[model samples]
Target: MDTRFLESFLTVAESGSMAEAARRLGITPAAVAQRIRALEDEVGTLLLSRAGRTVRPTEAGSAILARGRNILRDVRDLQALAGRGSIAGEIRLGAISTALTGLLPTILARLLAAAPMLDLYVVPGTSVELYRQVTEGDIDAAIVVKPQFAFPKTLDWHVLRSEPLIVLAPERIADRDPHSLLRSEPFIRYDRNHWGGRLADSYLRRVGIRPHERLELDALEAIAVMVSKGLGVSLLPDWAPPWPAGLSVAKIALPANAPERHIGLVWSRASSRIRLIQALQTVASQVSMDPIAG
Candidate 1:
């Protein structure tokens, strides 16, 4: 059976929309449907159920899902193994938004320079999503905020940076107490759903400061812009820089004892792309040592 067909089926199943799967695969919807039909034919089972625009996996499809992923992973591993001594082939690397903009570019530049044959496919997501993807082997590795919980033995993690929480406010309010500003000003809250955001939430609770919340979001750079426009004050990690330029915002430092947000690399220890991942880790380590380098 054609693995491409299986790939198409899995993509469609995950996305829940044929058009979306087609778009992601860079193919027409009709072509995706054709592949799905062919796969179903080969398997002698109906693999999917469709209702309106949404597509869901049938019982058979659901049963085969994990095995299908493993099959594809093994196939890719064979391809990478074919290269043997060379650090080549694609690495599906995920990163949170801040790391995507601030840290990944530097690491990618150095990594590609050292291994010109290496291909990188980057997936951007929240730390929570990226962590899940890494755990499930949907991606080889991720740059993300460190999870509060201990990692299972199947994975490995390395700290890249430790960003401390800071108050983001307009220059006009820069002089006010960091905790006081959070209580008085319209607060542009960091989304509590994220690991880093949870740190901010914990700090707020510990300090007994309930912000006068005006908005809640996950994007730090966008939050900086909002604060620059005097939309409200926010509490966020002092994430690696190249922050949005020309923003008249101030990053007010919290007390020295405040909690920190640790960003790191997380990857499957069993990935066939371990060599490439090691290369990535080396470059990431170098970049982390001198964050301003690119």
Candidate 2:
């Protein structure tokens, strides 16, 4: 069977749309459909069913999905191992929202400059979901908050940055005490569902202060906006910023012992994309070493 045909079939199966798969593969929808038909003929089975704009794999296609991925990965690995061509292929990378906004662009620029042929497919997701995707091999790697639990043996992690937690309060508050303001003012609680949120929660508990909870949300920028509007003060990591413009808020430092939120890359050791991951790691390390000035 032609690898190109198999690739097209797999792409269509994953994307659920021939047009989307064609766009990703840099081919026309007609070409993608032709490739899928060729693949179906080679396998002597009906592989997909179309409904409107979407396409789903048939039982035969479903049965071979994992094997097809493995085959394609193995072929790519073989090419890399043989030094047959330039390092070029799609890399699916998962990342958290803050990292997407704050850290990744510089690092990505460096990586692209070094490997001009490489293609990156970035998927934005929460840290928890990114970690799961990394472990499950749904992505080549992920940039996310350091996981709270013990690391499993199957994955490797590297720290990229350590961000200190800080209190964000409206500038007009007369009292400057971090703890006092935290307790007295209405609190815009960080959503407890996030790992960083849990860290903030732990800090509050350790200090024996219970905030007057007003609202709980996950977006840092939105929370900053709310605080600027005098809604309530918030506890958040002083993550890399192009913080909201004209926000009238002051960042109050936490005590010396406050937990730091560490962002890092996590990847499966068994992945075929180890070389790409290594290249990304090098770029990330360089970026971390020489952070860009705001």
Candidate 3:
């Protein structure tokens, strides 16, 4: 059976009239009818029945239509795969702002050097938004702090880095005991919905330490800034001195307990970019291990 005839027959069945299908296919109505007859002859069965100006599928037409749809879908997929042999298109990668600042550039540079034709588009958003985009297939993949949320069973996750959490206090207070620091100051907590926030909260609760009942904020940089101002103590991954230049890092160790933050790559198992993903993963692991991320 000719695939062209199957396409014409399918189009007629969908549009319900030869005139409409021909108009859509930019063919004459008589040509559409001829193709339909040829398809019927090949199958040795009637495909469509006329009802005034409209057409309805016969039993054979319904069967052929179902098979034709599958055939067309496979044809389109084959075409797509054929054209996707090169990594020469835009790649939209999303990450948390912190990750964007810390790790994204490194990965993008590696990706560009390896796949020169790829135009990288970087989207910086909260972990929650990035997770949704990854789940919905809006983003090709993501490099964000791991979220404490339900992931679809179809996704692949890789733990790229596990960063040690630290206490952010004034330069003068850096040497003080962490328990005393946490107890004496209003701990400016990050928003609890983020994975990092929830992880910090869980760790604090487990350490038998309670943050002062007052201040809370969301953004990492903002919390860092507040900690620098001596508004309160904050706990975050040990990356750098917080804002307000004079700030410094002090590592905190609890009895048999230490808080950790995870950064990782998340991608769909059904995604078409597996080779590119593997390449990115190879480079990303290196980026994750860089001393700058510390």
Candidate 4:
């Protein structure tokens, strides 16, 4: 089976449009359609469901999507391994929103400068989602909040940053006690669905503070904006900077024992791109040490 055909199918499935897939693959749309048709014939099943401009994977296609990704990854790994001691080939990296906005640009810049042949494809997701992606071999590695649970032996994790939880309040109320403000003021709750947010929730529970709940969402920057506008105070990780500018908010310190949100890198132990992964790790370490990165 031609891997190019498989690539076309996966790209089409991901983009939900053959034209878009063709654009990404640098091929004509008609050629992309032909490749998909050939792949469907080879696989002996209809792989996509088409409706006007939109496309979706059929049941059969969905079943094979993960396997297809793995196959392509292995092929790429083989090609990279054949290279003459140079880090070359794509790295499918997943990152949480904060890491994407905060640390990723520096890491990417240094990695590319050191290994000019390397290519990158970045996926933005929550820590939970990125962890799952790494475990499932969908991505080479991820920068994410550390998981509360233990990981399997197939994966390796390393802590990159330890962000402490803090009370985010408008400057006007910055003088108020953190716990008292949480209990008295309207609360903009961090989403407990995310690992970082779970830390905040666990802290609130441990302190026995049932805040006057006002609103809740996952985006930390958005939460900050709300706090800046005096919508409510929030408990959040003091995430790495480049916060939205002109926000008049204060990061009030939590108690000495407040649970910290650990941001880290997780990767598959079995990935053939270990050199590239190690290079990325090194760059992340350098960035973490840089005072301006915070």
Candidate 4, run of 10 with poorest lDDT: 79-88
What is candidate 1's local distance difference test score?
0.90
- How far in Å is the alpha carbon of 142 misplaced in model 4? 0.5
Q: Candidate 4, residue 6: CA error in Å?
A: 2.7
Q: lDDT values of the candidates?
A: 0.90, 0.86, 0.74, 0.90
What's the TM-score of every candidate structure? 0.85, 0.79, 0.67, 0.88
**Could you tell me how far off, in angstroms, the CA of residue 229 lies in candidate 3 after the best superposition?**
1.6
- List per-candidate RMSD values in Å: 2.8, 3.7, 13.2, 2.8
Lowest lDDT sum, 10 consecutive residues, model 2, at 78-87
User: Which regions of candidate 2 are displaced past 4 Å?
Assistant: 1-87
Query: Which candidate number has the best TM-score?
Result: 4
lDDT of 2 by residue, 1-294 (tens): 789999898889988999889887888999999999888888899999988877999999999999998887777666546542555766788889888887899889989999987878787888988898788777889999996787899999999899889989999984588888899999999888999999899999989999999999999999999999999999998887667899899999877787889999999998777888888999898887775512
RMSD of candidate 4 to the truth, in angstroms, is: 2.8
Whole-model lDDT for model 4 versus the true structure? 0.90
Compared with the true structure, what per-residue lDDT tens digits does model 1 show for residues 1-294?
Answer: 898899899889888999988987788999999999999999999999988878999999999999998888887788778876999987889999989888999889999999999977687889999999998889999999987789999999999999888899999878999888988999998999999989899899988998888999988888999999999999999888789999998889998798899988999998888998999999999999993732
Where model 1 places Cα greater than 4 Å from the true spot, the runs are: 18-41, 44-53, 58-60, 291-294
Better of 3 and 4 by lDDT: 4
lDDT of 1 at 210: 82
